[model samples]
Target chain A: MTAINPVEILLVEDNPQDVELTLRAFKKANLTNYIHVARDGAEALEFIFCEGPHAGRKIQNGPKVILLDLKLPKVDGLEVLQRIKRDPRTQMIPVVVLTSSKEQRDVVESYKLGTNSYIVKPVKFEQFIEAVQQLGLYWTLLNNPPTGGG
Target chain B: MGIDFTNNVTAGGHQVADQLAASFKEISDLRAALDEHAIVAITDPQGRITYVNDKFCAISKYSRTELLGQDHRIINSGHHPKEFIRDLWTTIARGKVWKGVIKNRAKDGTFYWVDTTIVPFLNDQGKPRQYIAIRADITARKMAEEALRQSEARLQTIVESLDEGLVVADLRGQLLHFNHAALEMHGYSSLAECRRHFQELPDTFELHAMDGTVWPVGQWPLARILRGEKLHDLEVRIRRINEAGWERVFSYGGMLVNDATGMPMMAIVTISDITERVRAAAEIRHLNTALEQRVIERTAQLEMANKELEAFSYSVSHDLRSPLRAVDGFSQAVLEDYGDQLPEEGRRYLQSIRAGAQRMGALIDDLLAFSRLSRQALERQVVNADALVRAALEELAPLQQGRRIEWRIDKLPACQCDPMLLRQVWVNLLSNALKYTRKRDPAVIEIGCQTNSGSRVFWVRDNGTGFDMQYAPKLFGVFQRLHRAEDYEGTGVGLAIVQRVIHRHGGRVWTEAQVDRGATFYFTLEEGITL
Candidate 1:
């Protein structure tokens, strides 16, 4: 969870395969290859808030996009999103809720918590890859996020 | 005291003789009157008949020759006992008169009641010489008296046999008569027992009207009737200290009996006990309240359970689909990354794994959707069936692209239903048609609407490999499928979802199919909705 330099994409996924697939999707898009992975919602919060083991990381040097998985082990992804959206320092950071939930309530709640994008990971790898690539490209190179990574 | 009549013949002897003759004439005339007017008869001192007058013979229905020598016993009715005859004889033998009403029998055996008197004629020695009995006919009066007794007996029998309680009271409110049932109704053993306490009926029994208002004694049935009020179906309540110790309800009918002058002389009241009916109605109300309470409790419990079930299924869909996605995704990724390095068998195995994962994913998603169909409340609106069918076909364009699907659409009517749910029904049924009809070269499929028996019917007919009729019953069940997975690529949830949605709108679904023939599925919406 430690990050001294500014990261491009922060991928918060509990499952290892999902994290790997997400990284590969970025690589295929030729988007920011410098992706940092947080295994659970708790570690994602620690990395973003610079607390616990990430105590010395500067809060301003944040990732360009935070890919948040709704289902997580420790603090729920919704709780993590709420913490970021409520905090003035991390409020402007683009948070994309990338999960395997197609539930309407989940989509609505994620958007209500200020998720920049809500995507249901498709079962087919090709579709998932395409969706992730577009998401990465849009947030990193296409869409101009706030300066200082918000 | 004048002189010896034989030696004292004088100058006035001739005159005295003439006066004596006149007195004799008077005595003979009086005897004739008695003989003609009375039923007269004479008996000797030995109680043998000496003579009978003509009047006696006619009244006794006998001839003079038959009655003259016979004693008075010939006309005796045998109704008088020996002591009665002996009393008459004793008085007559003592030279006193005996008089009594006597029943006498005639020669024809017909009887007559008579007022009789007996007198003894004395001899010079003061001994009885003969007895004479005089009688008068009184049978008409006796018959009238007997008829009155019989009439009273009949009235008593009628009053006692009645089912409803009856009470007759005088103008002064004194109970003159009460029947057997009235005693039982008053919790009394008999009329005498009721009469003992009924004198204070206003104090002994508490009375209330049918509406539970306290009723005064002056307004009671008998009292009202005494005041000449004829009432029908008058209900009242009486609180009794006996017989289950509960208040008894009764209905009474009252009538005032007037004398010949038309003045109210008596009050006749009829009462019927209605305790059982009143208590039964109360029991029904109590049972209804209890039943309603139980239903409310059961509904609340079911609602809570349903909420919990919805939550469980939501999480199951979210948690279960994630693994399937990862499996299918990584499998495809592997095949894409290193397919040439592997042998044919290895690539086939990876493809199989990917296919199985994708199937599992479809099953989980459809199952979740089917569960959501039940929990979603219906939002009924006027829905255009034609528009919904076209939209469903448009959504199925991907499946319909590669196949030669011939569409036979119709101008469908609008229905009052939830548009979203009805659209789902169309998608499921239409896609099912498209999927099952894949092998047909022409791939004939028709979507149309018809009405049968005043109900709206919609059908999706496909001319392709159809199912057996024996398995039609299981067609609409969750995860129930007749075809093999290899033959039909479905999660077995399409028809189930269709059935669920149609049922939510108060409709039903069914399918008709035969082996290797086309299948036609029909659905009916609720009746009488002006569809």
Candidate 2:
């Protein structure tokens, strides 16, 4: 699928520091792909479906992988996952949940909503870096995505 | 000695006259005696009245002329059967004497009983020519006998109709009477099987005590009553020997019945079937126990649910540490990347920022541990107290370095407790003591066990900076601190964790202290008793 301004990775996060740390960790892992950041679940859904402010973007230009933070400002991670998986236009994109909550319900619900991966943001900087690097390496480099248009 | 007229005519009339007079005197005496005691009457052939004496007329309430020509039917009370009257006539007609008791009616239409005798006089052909009937009045004795018999019949009716069983036995335990209900309770459809002596009851049916032990025949209610013991509400379980599984509980009350002269005559017992009552009582007791068990199970479930909820909230605090990680991480990044461009003061300010973030991280970690302790399942085992204390001291060895310290360690006996949690408790207490006594030139800490009221109490005494006793009540509360953070270097969650661990082991913790004097913490684990 080819489109105008196609994206490789989409980052859904509300905390700015977490975003910086995640991007830093990805860079350290040598993953320099074009990454688009959405500050909330609503903005991430808009970007995925090309709605509202993201109407100029093409739905056919879906990201290769989505890194989702569970706790978001307006729309929560589970709802955004549900919207994306329900619509065939963005369902094929792999979503990995990255949140600091180790609550069992959040993990269970994220999986139930069809999240491709779930990770608890570690407390230490080095451990967090390692967790993000491993997930980035596997989802972007190892896993293959379908090129067929929705 | 008939005073024969032929002999008188023949000769010697004067000599026969004296003998005839003596014979007449003897005959008159016999007639007088008969008239004195008996009501007498005479009947001729064909059953016609021929003669009657004054006694007969007086008893029949009739004049002599009124009874003179009447047969015995005139006084018949119609009480005896026809066959009885015919039998009397048959015996007399055959020229034999007849005797019986007869009920006869008097002339005044009243009834009377008579003891009667009839004598027959026969002719030369051996046929009865006349009949002489003699009777005596016996009405009073017969009426008394009738009243007694009617009362006995009434008593039998009452006893048979009772819902409760009544059994009467002689003093020797011989069965006198047992009513219908008594027979039914003994598992008998009829009295045939039950109509034996009380001693034979054990052969067919067995009686058991309340504890389900078979009772000897001597302990049977009948036997007890016969022994002159009065029983009240004595319960026994009974089952037929032939039908092993069938059983019933019976309540018996009885006493030894006495005759009018105060001698023991019979043993009388009353019984009631209490099988259903006993079963219902047992069922109620079982239901109560089950209800109590259900309540305990529900409470445990609620506690588990509450702990899970608390752990989740602390997990949210688990997320709080993430932001602190970023703060500490980015601050180090700033110092490592731009150290040469920043001024020395700015570098020190960044260091302070890192330190503050790290301390907040420690506080959050301690909070998580405190909540985790409440949810942790207590794993108890017998552990040596001395070892737990030494292990905690070894972990605190770094704090004890470069300091003058005196350690008074007492040998501790073994105790049953959660070894891991107890070690944590020792670490918290010893570290608190070591922290507060920093100003002391030579800090003295004592550890020992004292036997108090059969329970082992472990204590830790330290010469340290103790707070006012008024704040003792708040000492173990989470996040409650008496000393400033800069002086104490703690998050104030240590004592709360210690209290929680001790309470889970069915024990208690308390402290005694005076400001700057010293503090001694005492605790005891009484596991398996309070819980």
What TM-score goes with each of the models?
A: 0.63, 0.47
DockQ of 1: 0.38
Residue-wise C-alpha lDDT for candidate 1, range B284-307, written one tens digit per residue: 999999999999999999999998
Q: Top TM-score: which candidate number?
A: 1
The regions of model 2 sitting more than 4 angstroms off are: A1-16, A22-150, B1-297, B300-304, B307-311, B335-353, B527-531
RMSD to the true structure for each prediction, in A, is 9.0, 17.8
lDDT of 1 by residue, A1-150 (tens): 433346766888888877777676656655544578898989999999999998988788777678788889999899999999999999998887876757776888988988877667742335444554656654454353433433
Task: Write candidate 2's Cα lDDT for B386-499 as tens digits.
Answer: 899999999999999999989998999888888899999999999998999998979999998888777788899999998899999999999989999888788899999999
Kindly give the stretch of ten consecutive residues in candidate 1 chain B with the minimal lDDT sum: B1-10
Give me the runs in candidate 1 sitting further than 4 Å from their true place. Answer: A1-13, A33-68, A74-99, A104-117, A122-150, B1-179, B196-272, B278-290, B293-297, B336-345, B402-404, B467-471, B482-487, B503-508, B514-517
DockQ for every model, please.
Answer: 0.38, 0.18
